[model samples]
Target: MRRSRLTLTLALGLLVVLAGCLGPLQTTPSATDRSTDGTTLSTTGTGSVDAEADLAVVSVAVVATAQSADDARGQVASDVERMRTALREANIPDDAVTTSSFAVYPEYDYSDGERTERGYRAVHSFRIETDPARAGEVVDVAVGNGASEVQGVSFTLSDETRAELRAQAIERAVTAARADADAMAGAAGLSITSIETMSTSGGFAPVERFDVAESAAGGDARTTFEPGPVSVSVTVQVTYRAA
Candidate 1:
């Protein structure tokens, strides 16, 4: 009698397991598989190129701090206006000056803990684009007008130049990938069978920095400036498949 009861329980467990497995099997396919055009794509190819940038995008931010948050903010605002005036005086186009940040925060004495607040800090950041020849002058003009705090400075290529460099980089990367594929085919004593697939890659954009910017300010000394030619570069990656 016990053996029969045990067999009956085992059969019940098996039925439960089968029911769980088969329940979801009856569901309809998801709606995503049906395309409006009733077509599917299965193959893809990608290529890469490398080129040097012809233009430089430089980012400069000016920051200010004071015992009073309001005073600090007011000072930064005034300085920003003066900075614009100075840039205009230096013949920088108004369109080239863009404000990236305007922030006011309480200066905190973290040593006392997050609960205690100290003075205030005000910051205004600007993005300026000028001829590579005039970048140095723009930095000087900005600092002379009241830029006391420097948060970060970086450089990039302008859109037009970047496109140009990208084209070259792509071509080079494709050539390289092809060379690799060909080497594989030759070692096997087979002509390229077919390009199974291809893909592209991109990496870090670099900024060429001239260190002379440090001389932009001193208590009694005027900042003299000079800008050098800017070089921009782009790298492309490509993967190719063989016959």
Candidate 2:
């Protein structure tokens, strides 16, 4: 009777284990769903191209502090007008000068973990777009007129040039990816039959910074920079079906 009871317990355990395994087999994916067209070769490639910068964006601002908010705002406004006039006289078009920001806020001094209200501060910033060759001249004109702060200068390609370069960059990336895939397939004794999946992404905004403080301190002297070529880069991820 004891032997018969042990055999029955073992039979039940085996049935339970077999049922668990069969449950997963019922939901197994079909061969088509699990296939990758035999084998796949995956590769990523990057490419970059450089072109001369055609546009220069200069940031300048007028900052003022006074006992009252109204007084600070008036001071900043007056200086901004002066800067605008000087820029216009320097042949920068009115449309090229845009107000980037205008704000009047309270100034505070922190000492010994205590904050003290100082005064009101106002800031007016301008975004000036011009040719790369004349960027220095524009900066000088702004500072000499009324701009108290030279924010920064950046060189970039114009929209037309950027679009052209984007296409070239993508083409080069795809070419590189294909070359890598070919090499990989050949090494594995396989030939790439077709592309099973492909994706790409890339962009670039080349910036060469001109020291704002240095430009500001060089009083009456021309500020200049050799804005070098702007580069555009792109990357591609490709998965090729090989057989």
Candidate 3:
């Protein structure tokens, strides 16, 4: 009986030792160990492409003031109609011209620390989209036809052009990211086995504005404008695994 009990205790101790040896090992995180198993190199790459602007937007407003709001609004409406007619005659499509804003506000005059109602001012603003080459002509026509305020002119890429540029930018960004990863991996004496994760982001082109007077001077000579190139950029972040 004593020999059998000793044998059973020895067997149980051997089993416990084997279980401890076969268990999973735990390790703390380190610089190269971001994952549970820990082996990745992450980098961000950026690229940009320049494209010529194919379209332009011209903003104009017709402002009028009178003793009564009704009178001011009526005058502004008439002026806006005239401006629209001029734009149409200048070969601008009717659909391209749309009302942006219209408002009537009271003008205040403070002479002796007292607010007095001077008159009602009405403003009607319109945005016109056209080809870059015809931008100056459009502005000239609108201003000649009683457009009291010339907000500004801006240049931008058309929808189709923008989409094309965005695709190109993304492709370039990916290429750049891969090049960066290759360099990093080479330095570390490791080869990139696979891509663990990747993300992409797009950038918007800046709007180029033309310097024109607020109230365009009435003249026969058309205002010259320049539509500079528009640029689109993209960035990509890639996490690569090395073994």
Candidate 4:
């Protein structure tokens, strides 16, 4: 009995000594913890590049209504062919004109809470890409042929142009971020030691307005189109360590 008690006392003493050696729990610091360590500054800078749009996309649609679905579809097909011919005459290649949507559905007429089937309506929509200078002419040709509706026109930069602009915008953004950090550090009487983290995001091209009425009324007059400049913006968030 005495040996057992002595053994228990020794075990308790050893556990106390081990606890003291271990001290307290040690945890790995997280990203949030490091960011709020009171020794880092975070700032965001934005930059933009203005570039002329090189391509134009015209949205056009043809619609026809008839007593039968087949009849409506046939009429739509004919109109679509004529529109294609017009586009071809305007020098728009076959590959540049793409059929976006085609549908045929029954029309409904509601009067005095009574529903009646009026007729079948068919619709065919096309997307045409061409030079910005010739966008107005393309629209006129399509409208004069058989296209009943002009859905709006939009302009955009080509892939190569977009890439080039993106690079320039990012470079400007980084420079702006560095300048901002330097200014803040100088005002606070602190010096930037190193860059901790950086992140960037890109902006989209703005839509330019295209007047459908002007194009329709052009007649023999030259249809003028202006694809205004589009701005490509880039924003950068940078975190710097202060000393």
Candidate 5:
């Protein structure tokens, strides 16, 4: 019996030695055992779509200067009233016409070693918005009646119109990006296996890039108003996994 017990103890010792030799098996990679050959690449693509402008905005400033503050203000007040009347007669709503600026300021001239008060300057500016169809008429009245100055004219999207344009623009951008991908693949002698990832942005419609420079030069010819179109554009970036 003692000999049997000695044999069992030796067997147990051998099993313990085997466990120590194996230690713990690693299932995850360590810092030193990392792969350096992996690569992540990026590329960008652009798309553009053009559409005609659908809306217009214009700024008109009427300036009148006189020797006295009351005179300057009174002239501006009279001009404003006539301007409103002209707009109303031209079929523009009072609500559509808004006052943007109304102020009276003093002007001075320093000459002959003395300072002299030139006069008081009063100016009133208005921003007018209306349908594009009859925009020409509105401008005509402003020039013909009391508004002698056209600060600027711009084309833009209304709230509802802008939202619609944004979606259409994105669609066009995506289509363009895919077309570019196909072209690239063809050039590389490879067909598009499949798109792994697609990201896009840009292409907004009816841009307002075209500026309408005011021609106060037409001082005598009724200001010869011209309501021109404007262009607005947006940029988009697209990233796709090159198959």
Candidate 6:
């Protein structure tokens, strides 16, 4: 009887050693884990907000061509001065008128596959910042004063407006994310216990661009532009713990 008891004890010791060598059992979380609120539900939501543009940047250029580079530059400079004077008369602040680019290059004409040097060309571009309501007036003022080219007009929000819109967009995105999480949890017969993790990303939308050259083509007619709303968008990813 003593020998039998010793053999049984040895067998039990061998089983424990084998179990140790195998390590712990591997298991995956399943429905039971979700019931115990150990599972996470993740969802992504997006939001967009549109607001009327309050600021406008009008791009105007003065171009001149002459046989000599000096002559062309002189002409362009004179034209730019005239435009600046006009803008000032129109009540545009001096700080609002800024030079965007100035260049002097040789002009070429390609005809019948022959390239010929036409003349030296000078161009001076100006960016005039103003309110959207005055963009048309500003364009007219520049054109009447010697601006030969109207590049386009960009309508966008001011810094304060952008900040306000961004905040509203983010709030909308968070609300959307919570709604999605709640919907998904409810569909699965679970309730969101808490938000485990969340991340957000957003940005200001593209500015509205308008070309007023066609509208301004009518002689003696005032140029006008109606800008649309600029948008702000945001996206959020949320992970919720559910039971």
Q: Give the poorly placed runs of model 5, Cα more than 4 Å off.
A: 1-24, 28-44, 185-232
- A best-first ranking of the candidates according to their TM-score comes to 3, 4, 2, 6, 5, 1
List the RMSD of every prediction in angstroms: 14.1, 10.3, 6.4, 6.5, 6.0, 6.8
Candidate 6 regions off by >4 Å? 1-37, 206-219
Clashes of each: 11, 0, 0, 0, 6, 0
Q: Estimate, for each residue in 3-73, the C-alpha lDDT of model 4 and write its tens digit.
A: 99999999999999999989988899988788543468888988899988888899999999999999999
TM-score of each: 0.63, 0.78, 0.80, 0.79, 0.68, 0.76
Which ten contiguous residues of candidate 2 have the minimum total lDDT? 211-220
Worst 10 residues of 3 by lDDT: 211-220
Question: Which structure is stronger by TM-score: 3 or 5?
Answer: 3
| Candidate 4 weakest ten by summed lDDT | 211-220
Candidate 4 residue spans exceeding 4 A from truth: 1-38, 211-222
Q: TM-score of the candidate numbered 6?
A: 0.76
**Which pairs, if any, clash in model 4?**
none
Could you tell which candidate, 3 or 5, scores higher by lDDT?
3
lDDT of the structure predicted as candidate 3? 0.87
Q: What does the lDDT read for residue 12 in candidate 6?
A: 100
Off by over 4 Å in 3: 1-38, 207-219
Worst 10 residues of 1 by lDDT: 37-46
Q: Residue 65 error for model 1, in Å?
A: 3.4
